[model samples]
Target: MKYFAVFLPMLNEEKSKQYRGDHIAYLEEMDKKGKVYAKGRFTDGAGGLVIYIAETFPEVEELVKQDPYVKIGAREYEIHEWDMKVTEN
Candidate 1:
């Protein structure tokens, strides 16, 4: 599987907060399925990011398309393949 980084740029904060519960549920489900590795909002409040493990870009794209934020048009997103990881042991 390849790793993907999803960047969500919030379009409407009020709307986003309203749907945040649903969005969290979606992410939790993905996490249970092992499709999500990590997720969080940026410190500046611009938006959030989700790290995904999927076979292809289309696979990740489809996942994002189902997000509550996306469904409500509360955010726009960009997805990029993450091909490398570094860790200090």
Candidate 2:
């Protein structure tokens, strides 16, 4: 199963900046574990978004919960299980 995590950095830019390093580290770990598929921030002056491919929704949820952004209350996330039918190589 695949999961899509829609992360919205709340009005806590300062906190996000403070924890950015830890957050990136956590994301790198996830990538190494082959759990992350595609991830990027909303460079449109918005928030961020991340997509993960996992064994289950619970696994993805736990992963998201471990993010420094979420832990530090700098961002909140909404997760949805996905059924992807197409992709660009």
Candidate 3:
């Protein structure tokens, strides 16, 4: 599996709040499926990040498209394949 990072910049704060619960739920669902590596928000509140485990870019892209925040236009995102040269042991 490859790591795919979805860098989501907050767009509509109100909309985001409205769907925040659903968003987290979706991530948790994915995590249970072993589809998510990690997810977090920036302290500045400017955006958030979700690292996904997938075999192909399209798989991650599809996951992102299914995100509640993305589906509702509460956030804008760019998906990048992470190099991940280092990590905690």
Candidate 4:
């Protein structure tokens, strides 16, 4: 599996807030299906991050498009191909 980092920058807080429930549901569903590795929002509410493990970048992009935030244009995403080496818990 290859790692991907999705940077979610909130473009419209109101829109994001309006769709928060659906966004969270989508994240939870993906987590349950093992598509999401980890996710969280910034403390200041600026945006969030979602790490994913997929076979290719296109898979990650496709999965991201299904997010409510992206679907509604409440937020914009910058996806990066990531490489990580874990050394500590």
lDDT of each: 0.96, 0.81, 0.96, 0.94
- Model 2 clash pairs are none
Q: Which segments of model 4 are wrong by more than 4 Å? A: none
Score candidate 1 by TM-score against the native: 0.96
Q: How many angstroms is residue 75 displaced in model 2 relative to the true structure, after the best TM-score fit?
A: 0.2
Over 1-89, each residue of candidate 1 has an lDDT whose tens digit, in order, gives 88999999989999999999999999999999999989999999999999999999999999999999998999998999998668989
- lDDT of candidate 2 over 6-51, digit per residue (tens): 5655658889889889988988998998888878888764668888
Relative to the true structure, candidate 2 reaches a TM of 0.86
Sorted on TM-score, best first, the list reads 1, 4, 3, 2
Winner on lDDT between 1 and 2 is 1
Order of quality (lDDT):
3, 1, 4, 2
User: Which candidate would rank higher by TM-score, 1 or 2?
Assistant: 1
lDDT of 2: 0.81
TM-score of each: 0.96, 0.86, 0.94, 0.95
Which regions of candidate 2 deviate over 4 angstroms? 87-89
Clashes of 1: 0
Q: Write the per-residue lDDT of candidate 3 for residues 1-89, one digit (tens) a residue.
A: 99998999999999998999999999999999999999999999898999999999999999999999999999999999997878778
Worst lDDT run of 10 residues, candidate 1, spans 79-88
In model 2, state the lDDT of residue 25.
Answer: 93
- How many residue pairs clash in model 4? 0
